[model samples]
Target: MKIFVDRDKCQNHGLCAISAPASFQLDTDGELQYQESFDDEHIDDIEDAIDSCPLQAILLHPDAA
Candidate 1:
């Protein structure tokens, strides 16, 4: 799957990082960073991260056709 975050909508709250530590994190500068792609095994965690976004900034897409 693919993960995308809207920088304009996100506030760097780190909820995604908390929900999916294996896939997302806040850099030392406090900027949000994450895997653009992820394994299927991480789907649940990634979905949790998506749901955790208060701004609804996180989006999930299937692998490109």
Candidate 2:
């Protein structure tokens, strides 16, 4: 699956990291970081992250569908 985050819309809220720590993270500077590509097994967590994001900055590529 492919993941993309709209940096301009993101607020660094860290909810995505809480929802899917394996795929998303907040660095020491409280900035968001994530994997662009991940294992299919993490789909549930990735979806959870997407749902939890207040800014709706996360998106899955069409290939992820």
Ten residues in a row with the worst lDDT in model 1? 56-65
lDDT of 2 by residue, 26-59 (tens): 9999999898988989999999999999989999
Q: After superposition, how far is residue 2 of candidate 2 from its true place, in Å?
A: 0.7
TM-scores for all candidates? 0.92, 0.92
Cα displacement (Å) at residue 40, model 2: 0.6
> For residues 1-65, could you state the per-residue lDDT of candidate 1 as single tens digits?
69989999999999999999999999999999999888889989999999999999999877788
* Residue pairs with clashing backbones, model 1: none
Poorest stretch of ten by lDDT in candidate 2? 56-65
Model 1's TM-score against the true structure:
0.92
Model 2 regions more than 4 Å off: 63-65
Candidate 1: stretches off by over 4 Å:
none
